[model samples]
Target: MSNSNSTPLMARVTLGRALRRLRDEVNHLTLADVAATLSCDISLISRIELGKRNCSQQHFTKLMDLYGVEESERDRLAELHAATREQRPPWWARYSEVITAEYERFLGFEAAASEVFEYQVGILPGLLQTERYARAVIGAGFASLGPDQIDALVEVREIRQRQRLWDSDQPLSCCYVLTEAALHFQVGGPQAHQEQLQFLLELQERQNVELKVIPYAKGEEGAQIAAFRIFRFADDDVPDVAFGESVAGSLTMDDPRDLRRLHRLFSNLSAAALDPDKSRDLITRIKNKED
Candidate 1:
């Protein structure tokens, strides 16, 4: 499988999806069939379909021949070929500066997405974090991190949050589900936890936002999983993507089967969480304890 979290992977998926749509219009030519025709491994076909591998002009020519794509459609596929260069960012690109290469790709995808659905079991999602809260969280996780590194990480988090509401014609919509443990994590001690919890409440009031909490009693349901986000696009042009962190790195899933499983997981998790008002009340009760 390709490194799914890479921006190039996303571009590849966009290209593959366009090709797959063209293939579907022609007939039910399965990927396996295409691989057999190309005399390649099934894994290679899967990677091509998922945009995990870059396709060359020769590959494009082969696809046009196999799909019986028209001259105009051929032009469009060529456009995808053109995008190979377009997808590479400039030498001065800063969108990925402070983060790992894989995470930088994840950030690029999140920034470009139209909507994001996330669940955080251990701590607050970076998008909803305040500078102090973010720094504290980062420091806690990396005791060896210098103040300068923490500042840069916080800067990235802040930039990502600002982009969420970036006055674009297409602003990102966010739906966040957080666990009670997140509210009490105390990254910057009790005061910072209170402020962060308050920020969550305020975000819940936004038109493009919805926030919920899985109370402490929810136990395993609340704390069993690591945080993850699902990015959904308005363009039928692109497929929905799910990004989850691993010991190796973050993983992005574009395959319909994989996405379906993740979607189901999120749905069940959300269903088990408290509703917004109740979640807010749960947070308020926690805050009152600190008073």
Candidate 2:
């Protein structure tokens, strides 16, 4: 089951999409039609369908009645509506001082994801990063923060790894496509870098984790793309979301068009990357060179 505390937004999105589908495909109704039926402004209906606003209990029941929704489907949507209205604080709520709201939302998605597809150009993904490597990366990126803040951020990364990768009953299935340059970047000096690569090797032994390296020979296949991850959930109602990291902040998108483009880009990168065994060999060779 998806963790409700970590996935309320996901539920909201699912409910919104379902409402929109019912309005369009089933009833063939327009926003104006829904608005008129509910006796509310069209913008209210639009925002509700877009997941930007919550549907009130009265409005929700009225919409269900307006659409002539069947009992079973209405019950399911009601559960999703309840989930969206849940007020439980996420596990990362304590770290609110250190992380942005956008990042907190990403964490929520990550915590609820069953599988993750990631592509990195210059560094290891957080779930695969060693503590020291994480500290170094966080410290550099958040250079203005004090040591305590940096340590707290590092703790956040460690907690994320533990909850999603190590401690979960069903560990998150992960496929990572990384550029060869990622292995060579040496984020936390030679010792920490070496440890990070060795850790990657060990992680490859796990059934849930798969790592592939895009050799330098592959050139710029993934270079043009910023680091990004595609998160897939177990629930079909909650659509897959793509997250991109940038200097400014993180961006999350669930638009089908954007998802299709990202999917195509990831497919191309994966096809151009080295296979698992060879990718492991390349990592080992690089680690040896670090000695």
Q: Per-residue CA lDDT of candidate 2, range 31-62, in tens?
A: 99989888899999887876768889999999
lDDT of 1 at 32: 80
List the lowest-lDDT window of 10 residues for candidate 2.
Answer: 1-10
Q: lDDT winner among the candidates?
A: 2
Error of 2 at 123 (Å): 1.2
Give per-residue CA lDDT, model 1, range 1-291, as digits (tens): 122222454556778787777666665787788778887887876777667677877777888898888898678667666665465672225634457766765766776678888988878888888888988878887678788777878777787777666455556788888888777777798788788878877877777887888887877776655677899876567788888865565787766898888788788778879998898888888888885
* Model 1, residue 222: C-alpha shift (Å): 3.4
Quick one: best TM-score, which candidate? 2
- How high is the CA lDDT of each candidate model? 0.74, 0.88
